[model samples]
Every structure is written in C-alpha cells, then in structure tokens.
Target: MEIDQAGKTNGQQPLFPTPSSTPPPPPPPPQISLSLKRLLTIVNCLLLCLGNAGGPIIVRIYFLHGGHRQWLSAWLETAGWPLLLFPLSLSFLYRRRSNPSAPAVLITPRLILASAFIGLLTGVDDYLYAYGLDFLPVSTSAVLIATQLAFTALFAYFIVRQRFTPYSINAVALLTVGAAILAMHASSDRPAGVSVGGYWKGFVLTLGAAALYGLVLPLVELTYSKAGQPVTYTLVMEMQLVIGFFATAFSTVGMIINKDFQALTREAANFGLGETKYYLVLSFAAILWQCFFLGAVGVISCVNTLLAGILIAVFIPMVEVLAVVFLHENFSIEKGMALVLCLWGLASYSYGEYREAKEKKEQIASPQVQTSAV
Candidate 1:
C-alpha cells in the first residue's frame, strides 16, 4: 500500500518541481525614484546658477576694491580645482579594497592625456574670461557668455548626434536673437569705471571665452561617450580632477612666468579692503569658481551639454539683476527683452522634454499591456 501511495505521488509530481521546492524570483533592481531625480536636478541647477553668478560678482568686487591681480585671481580659481582630488582618492581606495575586479576610474593614459589637453584649453579659457571681466562690467560679461549656448547646441548636434526638435530649434533661435540684441545694446550703458576701448576688448575676450567653453562642453560629452564603459558620477569627478590638475599646472606656470606670485604680497598689502579681506576674497572666489565648474560638469553628466548650456544662459539674467543691484550696472531695454526671450526658450525646451518623456512612458506601457492581454 505504501509503494502504491509513493507511486501515485511521483506520478502527480510530473516533470516539474513542486511549488514549495521552486526557487523564488530575484528582487527587482534598485532605482532612484523619478521625483527624487527631478529634485536633485533642480537642486544642482540652482547651485550651478548661484555659483556662476556669485563667482563673477566676487571677482568684480575684488577689482572694484582696487585689486589689479588678474593673474592671481585666475590662478587661484584654477588652483582650487585640486580640491576634487580628495573625493577621487576615496573612490580609488574603495574600488581597490571592495571590488578588486572593477574597472579603474580613469585607467587609460590616452584618456588621461585627452582630459589634460581639455584642461589646458579650459585654463586658457579661464584666463581669457578673467581678462575680460577685468575690463568689462559683470552684466556685459554675462551677456557675452550667453552666446555659449548657441555654440554648444551647434557642437552638440555635430559631435554628439543630438537631435534638435522644432522646439529646440526655436529655443536656440530665440536665444541667439536675444544675445544679438544684448550685444547691439551693450554700448549704450557702459559702467562708470570702464572705457570704450576696454569695453570692446572685454567684449571680444568674453566672446572668445564663451566659444572655447562651448567647445569644452561638447568635447567632454564626447570623451565620456567614447570611454567604452558606463559613465558614473565617480568617473565624472575623476575626469574633473584630471582636468583640474592640468589646468592648475598650466596656470601655476603662467603665474610664475608672469611673476604674479611675487606681486601677490604687495598687492595684498596695498589692497583697498585690507590684506586679510583681500586674501579672503581671493580664496572665496577660487572656491566658488570651482563649485560652478563642478556643478556645470555634473549637469552635463546628468542631462546633456545643450541643457547645461541653456541652464547657464537662463541664469545670465539673474546675473544681470545682481550686477544691477551690487555692481551698479545698467539694465537696458534690450537686456530686458533678452531676459524675456530666455525664459520663453526655456519654457519651450521644457515642454519638448515633457512630451518626449510622455511618449516614452506610453511606449513602455503599451508593450506591457499587450503582453498581459495575450
């Protein structure tokens, strides 16, 4: 009877294991909540805006207070970039000890060389920007920098294969028009201390700075995409560290060659704000500029180069407002129009993003629904 019962149970078992013996399905992969991601993006954008706006203001204040140390300021700003090293070091140690087989943060010498080359360009870019700001009002400099958005869009299209929807086209067009208006009207409201010749020099230099930075943004995107591995925040920061190291090295050489380092002591002693405040201003400016650099790069990693450029462009008006309040610069009618147009372009881009996201969600959901129905 027992053998008969065992045979009956075995027959019932069939070819598959019983439910109790079957293994459970694996857990779903971890993911950041959509809302959290959006919130983080917003926070990063705000920080980027604030840092960009404030860095210039601090430098302007230094100059306003009779600080003629252009090279010093530029060097300090580039020098602070090494602050990224601490985090990068931690990442390396963690990866080595915890995940011995994981890919190194930036292992290839060719990649390092490429990043350093970009950093050298960035160092030159920073000096030009500083040279411009030394001669131009903060408001005018901000306007010129806005031109970077157009250049960034152009480069992104060619280099990254970023597709431009009609909305993005409209955004780019409007932004360009607004910048042109600003440039045309730029001569009308020269700051009290600046001369016509200086203004033009500043204008040209600032535009050059913008163009170089535009190239930098797209090239960064290209480098990461070509990395042959998935890019992460750690990798992004590591790239920044490499770039910063090279940039700082270049600037340090410039400082030494120009004897800017030798003049630093005398400049500090003769500073209008006194020696301590003068050093403080330089320190703060350097740190703030690094913050802006990091924030911009972070934004690029999180979104795209075009979006990062747009965010910077959008904040130009805020920088203008700040210039008006603190630096006593003019806010002409053209500048007002520029601000309005920037807002409009931002809205259009945002709407396009929303539509694209919606379509993607629908596409993903449709497949699931069809499978369930079947």
Candidate 2:
C-alpha cells in the first residue's frame, strides 16, 4: 500500500519526491546594504542632538530661577563637584590597571599629552556651546547642534574609511527636516527670553565650538587607538579633564581680574552659599552622567550610546512639566512641541538601529550554521 519498493510506479521517482527541491536552499537569507548601516550612524547622531538640547534646558531652568552665568562658572566655584569626577574616573582607571591582562608599566607621558589635548578639545567645545546659547533658544540650539551628526559621518567616511549608505542620506534628510521645524519655531517667538549679552561674534564662536567638538571623536580615536586599551582610555579622558579645567579657569581669569574681590565676596555671602551649593550638586550630577555615558558607550556600540541621549531628552520635558504642576511655574507650548519632535525623531532613529542590528545578527549566525551543515 505504501508504494512499490525500488521500482517505478506510474513514473514516480519516490513517494517523498526524493527531496527534489533540496529544501529550496533555505530560502536564501535576508540581504542588508551599506545604506542601512549609514542610517544607524545617523540615529546615533540624533542621540547626540538630544544630549545637546538637554544642556540648554538645564541652563534655562537655572536662568528662570535667577541664576546668571552659572553653568560655566558653577563647576569651578564648587570644590566638591569637580573632585567627584576625578575619583569616579580614577576608580575606573584603577580597575583597568588591576586587570591581569593590563601591562605592568605606568602610563607614559606621551599618553598623558594626548589625553590633555582631548580635554582641551572638550573644554573648548563646552565654551563654544555656551557662547551659542547666548544668541539662540534652547530648542534652536538643539537643532543646530544636530549638525554634529553630519560632521561625525563626514569624519567617519574620510578618516575611518567607513562607507556611507543611502539609508544614511535618508536619515540625514529626516533630521534636517525636524531641525528646520524646530528652528522655525524658535526664531518666531521671544517672550521673557534672555537678551543676547553679545553680538554675531558670539554666534560665530559657538558655531566654531560645535565644529571643533565634532572633530574631537576622530582625534581621540586617531591618537589613542594605537596605544589605548579600554582602561588606558579612561586615563586619557582624565588627563583631558584636568587640562580642560585649568584652561577654562584661565579664560575666566577676567572674571577674577575685573570684579572687586572683596565686594564680590561680600555679595556672595549676602546671596548665601545655598545657590552655589545647587551648582555643586548639578556639577556632581554632570560627572555622574559622564560616567554613565562612558559606561553605556563601553557596553554597547557608539551608535547605541548616542541614541540613548533621547532618553535624556524625553525626561527633560517631563521634569519641566512636574515643575510647572507642583512648583507653580508658567509653561510654554513651544517648548512642548520641540520636545515632542525630539522624542519622535529619537523613536524613529532607534527603530532603524534595532532593525539593522537584528539583521546583522541573523546574517552572521546564518553563515556559521550553513558552514557547519556543509
């Protein structure tokens, strides 16, 4: 009843068809392209955008509460906050040093010099950003800052020999559209906004800073990729921080030189150290954030690390809303819209990255399986 054994019946080859199709070659695995990867890189840049926006938002809150020019000066003015980062970073460095695989020799002067350069770059980047805030809205500044993604891609293409894809171009278009929307909203209105303390000169300077910061990543990679182990990377960063702190302090020397030392001290006491203490707390928070950032980058790819900034942006508006409801502050709808755009952009960016990653994982696993089967 099953079929004639080893004999043709009605010209049939076999009852199971003799695996004629060869399982259709497993349907040929899914294909990915260079363009898709470029999209992911853009998504990472979106994360950086959110981070850029968050800074101004923080500064704005301070400004609303009668804190003037604090973001730049607060860290140095407080002893506790600056020291916090040093210890945390040092702890990380020590852990790396203690690893059995780490070399026995101490870090060299050449490494320190390289690290200092990075620090200087970082310090200048901050100053430039602060300068831009003097002329632009928090929302607009965030959009403008998104340009760094473009810069990052440009650097990657030219320096790292990374290729760009069509997806990257599309991602750039989305970011640009969103940024333009945000920028239009920012420039359209001004109510109780801080007056520009300077002129076009300030704007130009800030733009320069953004460009320089955009350059820092490549520079760091170029210098340290040769000798930097993961632990040594931390040491490099620490060196940069040390140098940046001093450099910034030197620039602000005018604050010390021009102001009456005795009168300023008296005024500081009258205002009470409570406000200064607030700066100290924020500075510590900044340091903690930096640690978190570095850890995130270390554990995940740089793309993921950058995209995580959207989480920060998402939180900013929520915090602002809570302040308005509980603390009784007036709210601006414009700020709300800007936040919404940033969140949406972030979501799109993240989805694109996830899809790309999932595709890559499948692609890698499939080859191995095929080879084993063969």
Candidate 3:
C-alpha cells in the first residue's frame, strides 16, 4: 500500500490532535429575585427569634440553680465563647487563603471604622436588652422589641443596597400595627412591683436597642458580602463580643465593689450550695452561649437575621405567660390581645412570604416556555 501523505512515514499517528484551547463558558450570575429574597428574609427572622429566646431561658436557669457573680466574672475573663470560635474562624481563613479569584472588597480603614461602629451599636442594643430584662417581663421586652423589624426595613432601604418593595413596606406596616397592639397589652399587664419609671426606662432602652441594632445589621452584611472573608465577620462579631464583655464585666465588678456581690453570694449560698461562685459561672456560660448563637446569626444575614429574631417574640411572650402563671403574677385582657395580634402578624408575614415565593416560582416556570418557543 502507498504511504498516505498526511500520515507519518513510520505509520505512527500523533499522540494528540492539535489542541484547540477554548475558554470555558462563564458562570451564570446568581438569580436573586425580590420574592425569593423576601422568603429568605422571613425564614432568617424566624430562626433568629428562636435562637434569641434561648438566652433568657438560660439566665433563668442559672439563677434557679444558685449561681453567683464571681463565677460569671471568671467565665467572662476566659475570653468567652468568641474564643471558642477561633477554630472555625481559622478554618475559614485558611480555606480562603488560596482563593486567588476571590472577589475584591477593599478592607480599608473606613470599612474597619464602620465595622467598629456597627459593633458598638450592636453592643449597646444587647446591653439595653440584657439590662431591661432585669426590670420588665420578657413578654414586654419581646413585644416592644418587635418594632425592630420596621426599623430594620427602613435602615436597609436608606443605608443598605436593598431596595424596599411595596410588599416589604406593607409587611413593615402590618408588623408595626400588630406590635403596637402587643405593647398596649404589655402596658396594661405590668405587675405591681414594677416601678413606672423602671418600666418606662426598660421600654425606652429596649426600643433604642432595637433601633440601633436595626441600623447595625445591614452595614455588617454589606461589609461581609463585599469582603467575602471570614475576617470581616469575625472582626465585627469580635468587636461586639469585646464591647459586651467589658460592659458586663464592669457592671459585675461595680456590683462586687459596692458589696452587692457578697450579698448575692450569701443569699444563693444559703440554699445549701457550697458557694455562689457556681451560679456566676453558669450565668456567664449562659451569656457566652447566647453570644455564640447571636454571632452565628450575623454570619448568615445581618438585617434578616435580626428580623427573624421575631421568632423569639412568639416564644418569649408565652414563656413570660407561663412564668407569671406559675409565680401567681396577674395576667390581663391586654396580654391576650397582644398574643392574638402577634399570632396574626406572624401569620400575615408567613402568608406574604408564601405569596411571594409562589410568584417567583411562576416567573421561573414561565421563562422556560418562552425559551423553548425561541
């Protein structure tokens, strides 16, 4: 047979064809529609509520088991739960280290300053919340605090990149109306031992905390998403933890210096506990746990997570009701009204989410037909 001109004279074919280096197809952009986003928001808010409610329950348990201030002081001194997160945070840091293609978010001094502001504001909000619980029923706190969702929506619209749709606006209005009714109920149900001034102070503190917290969330979210780094999330949370740790620590120290610590220890020790130090430790543990959970919420969605904390609104009121019933505290018609309004508002929020989700699904499906026809 004649040798083919295109073939190798030795009858050996090339090991590889001429390589055609075509660039890979670009990835599709993430599809985030308003409806889908709203659903995520509602879900996030619900989880936050549930997580937040746990904090009060833990505090109650620590005192019930004869905890004391020294223990709380020491627990805080140990670097708290934020220290515990070092491992996970390090893992995230390392994983991203080799990611050369990661999105560029300028971690400038300005951003760090903003992060600090958000952290400080967050600390203030939680400080007020913790302090208010001392004077007011958790129900009252939860009810008044529900206004945070409305406040957050406003902050997100003005500060964050999120555009407020008509539905979001209506959700805020409905939630506000429902929360106002709940607040009215709380006012009516105030116990005899709660001073008018104390009640008002608690009210103002909770509201301020909620409003400031509302502002903090979106900013942190903007920073973290843009930065795409664990450091930003860790940094903001660490600042809040540091601020909270100091504030609480100083307050505990003041109590010790003023001799209230000894009095509390003596009282708790009389219950046959060897010392009141255990109580303090347990209390610190509880707060530490709360800090960890709350920080996790921030990692997910700043504003949405806080709004989802309204889930606590549901349980907190019920928990308070149960505590009052057990302790022979008076319950009134307003509490009933408040609970009803809360339930109604929760249902409305859920319905709105469902409706939005359905719309998104329909839109996603409708696009397929047009694509096929084309």
Predicted model with the maximum lDDT: 1
The lDDT-based order of candidates, best leading, equals: 1, 3, 2
- How far residue 198's Cα lies from its native spot in candidate 1, in Å, is 2.6
- Number of clashes recorded per candidate: 0, 2, 12
Q: Model 1, 1-374: lDDT tens per residue?
A: 22243334434543445455767875542465678667757766876887788888999888888887667667766677778878778878887897676565654676788789999999899888888888888887888899999889888989898888888888888888888888786776566778889888888998999999999999998888887755666767778778878887888887888898888889889888899999899989888888787878778777788888988888888888888899788778888998999899899989988888899999999999999999
Give a tens-digit lDDT track for model 2, residues 1-374. Answer: 44676544666665555534465543332343567646644553443333333445554443344444433432232112254365555656665676644433344677667755665566556656655655554444555665565565566556655444444445555554545555555544332454544434445665676466556655555554554443333443454445445545543553456453334444434433455755553464354334432332322233322333233333444444544564344456655665576566556666666778799999999999999999
- Per-residue CA lDDT of model 3 for 139-162, tens digit only, reads 676676677776666666676556
Q: How many clashes would you count in candidate 3?
A: 12
Judged by TM-score, which candidate is best? Answer: 1
Worst 10 residues of 2 by lDDT: 72-81
TM-score of each: 0.85, 0.60, 0.62
How does model 2 fare in lDDT?
Answer: 0.49
- Give the alpha-carbon lDDT of every model: 0.82, 0.49, 0.55
